[model samples]
Structure formats: structure tokens, C-alpha cells
Target: MTPREQIGKQAEREYILHGKRGVTPKNLAHKMGVKLSALSQLFPTREDLILEVYRINVQEMNREREEALDRALVDSGGKPLSIESIMDARILPLARRCIEPHKGVQYQVGLSRFFTESSSIKNRILHEQFADLTQRFIDEIERALPYLPREEIRRRFQMTMAAMLGVCGILDMAAYGKEPARSEQEMWKMVHDLRDFLCEGFSAPVQDRHSPSSIHLNDGGRQWQVPLKDIACINADGDYSRVYYASGGCDMVRQTMKAWESIL
Candidate 1:
């Protein structure tokens, strides 16, 4: 590889090991067995190096996803694309990457920097790459479910992506957190459950916003009503419960699980 490419690879490794806040030019230089001045000469700013690493990683991920999609298509022998096939090609690989050691940490690190970084350049780079990947997946999904409107497909795709990312985040925390380590089988089960949940969500008809069943909620001083069917799930937390909506909104309400169950 060229010197610039080598620097980018080394920087990515540093980012994975130390996370966004932990990585620095000086430490990266030390790890690379080079002087700070040499590294500075190659990358004038730390952000530049970070952006390069992000670009390389995004390109590599896209390439892998494309190859997986191709293999799935070939394996089907010209049969109609199923949601399971598309998911196998798309989601499972990402879950594996998130669970794998060292290598998968690259994804976690990239996602962290993507959200936490404030630089306009960084945001543009991340957003453009993410949008491109999302569009490609949506196009493939359209082929699988042609009957659904493009807007509805996009909405379901966004929700599925959010759930998949949340699973990855949780896995990352479990791997590095104080809790006991989860078995590989358990991790895979979580991923499969997420895939099943997403497939069901994609197949389900869109909920009507004008449904008569509504739940009254109070957020501090503000009171509002939410459609009952819009609720995706509820989690009990002591005396209060957290409500998750299918539209991706969440709220904490002063109600118990039994109260919610009895009301429903």
C-alpha cells in the first residue's frame, strides 16, 4: 500500500482501540513507530486522518454488502427475492461484524465518531456515504416488495436500520461493559430475533393515525395523546414504564406494567 493508505489503516486501528476521544496524532505516531512531525506532514489535521479512515471503511463495507447481495441472487437461481434472502445478504453480515473481535470494533468506532463529531466536513462525509448505502438497500427492497409504495418501503427501511444499529450498540456495550459476556449463540439469537421483527414490521400494514384508541401521556407539564396502535412495545421500569412507538418516538409515563396490561 502507499504511505497515505498505510497511514489511514494505522489510524483506523488506533480509533478502534482507543475510540474517538482516545485517538490522537501523537499516540498514533507512536504506535506507527514514527515521529509526530512525520505524521503531521502526511495529515495536516487529525480530522483529516479521521475522515480518510471513515471513507475507507465505508467503501469497504459497501463493497462487502454488494458482494453478499450478488451471492444471494445467484444462490436463488433466478427465483424471486425473499425478505429473508435480502436480510441474509444485508443484516446478518453487519451483525457478525459487530460481534467479531477487533475487526467489528471499527464499525462501532466509526458510528461513534459519526454521531459525536461536530465538524461540518465530517458530518457531510458521513451523511453522504450513509445515504448512498441506504438508497441502495431501499432499491433492493423495492425489488423484493414491489407492491409497497416507495415511501412506505423507505419508512420501514429506516425503522429496520434503527433497530439493527441499536442491536449493534447493545452488543458493543455487552462486549465491553461490566456485565458478564454473552455467548456467541445468544448474540446470534438476538440478531435473528431482530431480523424476524424487522421482516414482520415490513410486511405489516401501516397503522392509521386517526385510530380512535389513544393513550393520554404527560411529559413534565405537557400533556398529549398517542394512538394505541402506534405503540410498538412497553418496558417496565420500577413504578413507571417506557413506551416505544412504531414511529420511533419514546416516552416515559407514570404507569405500571399491570396498569398498561389491564388497560389494554
Candidate 2:
């Protein structure tokens, strides 16, 4: 590793292992066996050093998450990922880390504070960088949901991430093993809630309840009537939905249900 990289790794190690209590250039310099002045040359400010350490750490974490996703996908034998499997692949690992070894708690708390509290220019830049990188997880979800339109994929992906992040915050609280105390039951509730929320979108609708006669489809600016008995099924394709009926198949309409009603 280059001198710069070596400095970052050492800083991350110190910060994670003991920096939670407190860490300063002098303290880190002492730990690195370097003169304070030398360390200062390498990292001009505390934020600079902390951000560097976090940037590296976030990259490593993203890599691990991606690897887990790949493994989950492979294990499924080319099938789309289930909500339970996705949560297991992504959240459970970190949750385990938070309680085990204890260092993981420190690491998570440090990162949570760095992103939420720090207003440094470098911190903001790193924030955006990680946000884009994090979207890769959403891409994984889209892969698992290849049937959904891009717009629907984005909507569901955003909600799913919101739920995931909330769970992380709760896990972080539990890791402290104190204050606003979380019970074991509460943690399990969060897991079940997340699963149910995602499953609502993926699970077959209660009896595919949309009335066939009431359904109106618009395809390429032309309106079509879909009478219940005449219809076979409605399926989604990439960017388009298809309607299969007794007569044959046609691309599904993009109109809203209400709008379809208005036309009728």
C-alpha cells in the first residue's frame, strides 16, 4: 500500500478499535509511531482523516454486501430473490456484527454520526459518493424483480431502502444495550414488519381482485375493453405490460385504474 493508504488503514483501525472513546492526531500519531507533524502533513484536519477512514470502510462494506447479494442470487438457481433472503443477505450480517466482538457497534456508531452530524465539505462529497454506491443494492432488487417496470422498480426500491435504514437505526440502538431500550421482541417485530412490507408488493394480490369487466386498458394511445370472461391474464414486460385474452395477446395499457374508469 502507498503511504497514504497505509495511513488511512491505520486510522480506520484505530478509530474503530478505540477511537470511539476519543481519538486525536496526537493519539493516532503516537499509535502509528510517527511524529505529530508528519501525521499533520498527511491529514491536515480531523475531518479529513476521519472521512478518509470512513470512505475506505464504506467501500469495503459495499463490496461485502454485493458479494452477499451475488451469493444469494446464485444459491437461488437464477430465480428472483425473495424478501426474506434479501434481508438475510444484507441486514442480518450487519446485525450480527453489531452484537458480536463489540467493535462492530463502534464502527457503526462512528459511521452513523459521521454522516448525520458532520457538515464538512469532504463529508458531503463522501455522502453523495456513498449514496450512489448504495443504489447498487437497489439495482440488485431490480434484478430480482425483472418483471416490474422501471418506474415501479424505483418506487418499491425507495420504500424498501427506507424500511431497511430504519431497521439499521434500531439495530444501532440495540447495540448500545441501553437507552430507549429495545427488547428482543421489538427487534423481531422490525424484521417481520420489513418482510411484510416488501411482501405486499411481491405477493399475489388477494385473489387478483380487479374485476375483468371493470378493467380498461390503454395500449399505444388506443383504448381497449377487457371484459372479464374474455381475459386470460395480465402480465408485465420491461417498460410495458401485456394483456392476454381469449382472442390473443396485446401490450397492456398504461392508464390509471381511475382514468380507465373515466374513459368507460
Worst 10-residue lDDT window, candidate 2: 203-212
For lDDT, the strongest prediction is 1
**What is candidate 2's CA lDDT for residue 50?**
74
User: Per-residue lDDT of 1-264 in model 1, one digit per residue for the tens?
Assistant: 987888888888777776665457777788889888988888878777778878887777767777887787788785557887777667876787777766665676666656667678666785867676667678878888887888889888888888888787676455557677666677788889888988988877766534449887764577888878888988998988898999997899888888777656
Candidate 2 on 179-231: residue-level lDDT in tens?
Answer: 67555556656666666766665433233234434566667788856676776
TM-score of 2: 0.55
**Least lDDT summed over 10 consecutive residues: which range in candidate 1?**
203-212
